[model samples]
Target: MTALIMIGAAVLPSLILLVYFIFGDRFPEPLGGILGTFFFGVLTVIPVLVFAAPLTEVLQPDLLAPIARAATEGFILAAIPEEAFKLAVLVAFARNLKAFDEPMDGLVYGVVASLGFATLENIAYVIGSGDGWLSIAILRALTAVPAHATFGAIMGFYIARAHFEPARRRSMLFAAYLVPMVLHGLYDLGLLATSYSGDIAWIVLGLGTLIIAVVWALRLQRRLRREQQAMLAGTAAASLAAGPHELRG
Candidate 1:
């Protein structure tokens, strides 16, 4: 019973985020495609582990100050490799597909992909926590899972902009990677440092980072919705203009 509850707690948060992001769209993506993107997201862990393992091996924590060590582990060892692979998966699988016509699609797919990654990570953490799995599960539900969703939203926001404005792909692509990378890194840095030093400040900042991520996601959702609505309204107007005068109604 305990293990079952632990697993549910770990997965439920990411699933909720997934459902919210999917239904939030005016035109929700096809269920089949969303699941496909999610499957690809699950596969992304393979690459992250492959690349991250080597870097982790090389980065000796004793050589640096505690703060610097935390930052290096979070930013360099974890965030860069993980976010890069996720960004690649988003670009490779969904960016050019017919389903990716609107900005909202970017948000949808990005959330899906991020949730997939979070789900896997959650399972690992829960199972690895032994008798204390319940605490680990609850803590991650609040922190890690939502953080992943926020990073996904950030990546997708820029991806949507990049799709609409191809000329700005270079800069937008950079933002897509940089924004989440920094946020995830800072999140990890704070939490990891707190774990090592027993400093409440780092924990507070880490939680603050998650709060910022949630706010940013909400704002991005609003922006994407507005853009989608405007485009739809323009299409309606153009269609009406092309209709016969008597049929204008």
Candidate 2:
């Protein structure tokens, strides 16, 4: 059925990304913790939708100019509030877990939260499309879902970096919030531009922005994975040298 396909479209991409990041982790997180983070991500959407309506209205102020209003909504209103809430959820619910031991954990939790948000958002968009639900679902699967995952990856990378390298915590913490916020704003701005300009060029710009965002995130993830792998190796060597039963206490 169409509804089933739409659901698949919403969930499958998130799951694929989730699996990719989860497996890449040198220290696997607890399944329950990961699911809880995902659930919190779903919960964050409610606040985003509720706050976004008023925030957009307040930020725009330009009631008569459609393009200006849309652009403002995309960059200032929606991006800031949405990513802010996602960061809040990460800090409040996911960050302090005992399983959050390494840099990869930050990436895992960030992606989990982002994918959860994307999955719910995707379902709504797909269903609202009515007869065109399939096309809508497919389009979002390729674009929006991956975008959220990449944004989350950026957030996670900085968060873990801040944790491991405490001397640089101040800068890394700021980046944990700012990088994703800017990227989200840019992506949304490009999408809104296509509507305002009615030019295929806007679509090209949007796709280009997406490619850059994804590449940036991937590079960060790879670097973090390598660092975590080395840390894990060092920990294992220390543990073995300490003797089998002589655990840290």
Candidate 3:
């Protein structure tokens, strides 16, 4: 029972986020594609572990000063590798999934992919806490998991635009990788710094980073939604202009 409870708490946050993101869209994704994307996301852990462990052993981030350590761990050790694979998975699914028909699909798939990775990562983290696991679970549910969601949303938005906007691909792709990379780095930086330095200010910085990320992601979602609406309206207009034979409606 204790083990089941532990696992449940670990998994619950991702489930809630997944459901909420899917329902928030007027067109929710098909179940099989969502599950498949999530599964690919979960598999990203394999690459992250393979990538980060060797680098950690070589760099020894723990021995560095708090701020330097935070930067190294936050960006080099965690965020870059994790986000790289997540983006890779998103790219793969975007090419393969038929449901990925709009810019909003990018946001949705990006978030779900991040959630998939976060779910497995969270479970490992909570279970690793041993008997006193509730705190870990609850704290992560509130902060870390949601943080991943925002990063995914932000990354997905740009990557989707990059795909659709060939002329803007260079700039859009840069934002896709760079924006989330910085946000994830900053959030981890503050948290790790606090842990190492035992400073309230460090945590404040970390929490503040997450707050900013959340706000930014919300704005990105709205922007993507507006673009998607315009695309749909344009398509409708084009079809009507083409005559009744070509109209999808």
Which candidate should be chosen as best, given lDDT against the real structure? 3
- List candidate 1 segments past 4 Å from native: 62-64, 232-249
Predicted candidate 3 versus true structure: per-residue lDDT over 1-249, tens digit per residue = 998899999999999988877776666789988898899999999999999999999999988987888889989999999999988998777535888877878888888899999999999999999977999999999999999998998898898888889899889888888899889998999999998878878898789989998898778777766776787798889877888665554
The TM-score leader among the candidates is 1
Worst 10 residues of 1 by lDDT: 240-249
Give one digit per residue, the lDDT tens place, for model 2 in 62-146.
Answer: 6636557556877667778778888876777788888887778888899998888888988889888998887887888899999
| Clash pairs detected, candidate 2 | none
Q: Where is the poorest 10-residue window by lDDT in model 2?
A: 61-70
Per-prediction TM-score to the true structure, in the order listed: 0.91, 0.89, 0.90
- The lDDT values for all models are 0.86, 0.83, 0.88
Over 4 Å off, model 2: 57-66, 235-249
Q: List the candidate 3 regions with Cα displacement exceeding 4 Å.
A: 226-249
TM-score of 3: 0.90
